[model samples]
Target: MQSVDVAYAEEWKMDHGIMVPLHFLTPRYDMDIIPVNINCQGPPLTPLNRVWEFGKALRRACDSVPEKIAVIGTGGISHWPATPNSVKIVEEWDRDYLDKWLANDKEALLAYTDEDTLKDAGQGGFEIRTLTAISGLCEGKKGDLWFYEPIPIFSVGCTVGVMEV
Candidate 1:
């Protein structure tokens, strides 16, 4: 096991990233939740390769416990949010990413550099870290893309998927 320092939030606010999905999946809001956030928006961001390793480590940690756990990774696919190109939705880029993600192609997924993501998919594409982590957790397992649509109004490609773990 890798020795890494884990930080805890003293005060937590349920951001839309977690709340929107939970609002649909757990309407009752009774179940416990542990939110994991990847630094997709800031400098010194975690590298894609390290993100994959983190996901693998997380899987091992979850497996060490007896309780049933469900991990949900939520994020926008390819859209330029809060920028002059906010209306832009890179459908081609999103589709290509979804293709690799569904196949759990680690090589393809990790091949993305921040510069490439920024150039092709815009800043919002950084959120793929969360989805890529899910891919890592389900390494060697394929996933299903249940729904994916570019919702210009929302400025994101609304996506829902599940990976076999």
Candidate 2:
């Protein structure tokens, strides 16, 4: 997990590098103790365009390590998690996001720093960064849109899916 907070605290953008893997600190996920790449470069607060480098680094790790790796990038398709956006949801953007994922459109996927993502989609939409990176990691692989729903409780356009090599 690349400590984006720590890295950001030092005023650095996470370009390309893997951070120490941490044990599932909390019960949020039931993932194994194995290393999980945590790319925090794109958070709800300040999202950076580190997608290209971030994905490359993960690809490198997957190839270098002897263990089988399954990289799962999780985040909202759109919808800001805080502020005035807490009550809003962008189903259109979410659907389009899933569409791009299912189609494996890397170019379009990495090209979403538009005002819609922040202004309309809300700050939470920044989470798309992780999804963006994952798609890059699984370039040329087949991915399925397992499920998608915009839950109002959390005010996020949630997506559950898989990308298989």
Number of the top TM-score candidate: 1
Clashes of 1: 0
Model 2 segments more than 4 A misplaced: 1-49
lDDT of the candidates, in the order given? 0.89, 0.64
Model 2 over residues 2-83: C-alpha lDDT tens digits? Answer: 6223243434443222221122332445655333334433544334345645665678768987988677676666665656
Expressed as tens digits, the lDDT of each residue in 24-131 for candidate 1 is 989999998888888888677889998898888889989999999998888888878888888889999999999999999999999999998888998889999999
Error of 1 at 113 (Å): 0.6
Per-residue lDDT of 85 in model 2: 58
TM-score between model 2 and native: 0.71
**Superposition-based RMSD of candidate 2 using all C-alpha atoms, in angstroms:** 6.7
lDDT, residue 114, candidate 2: 49
**TM-score to true structure, per model:** 0.95, 0.71
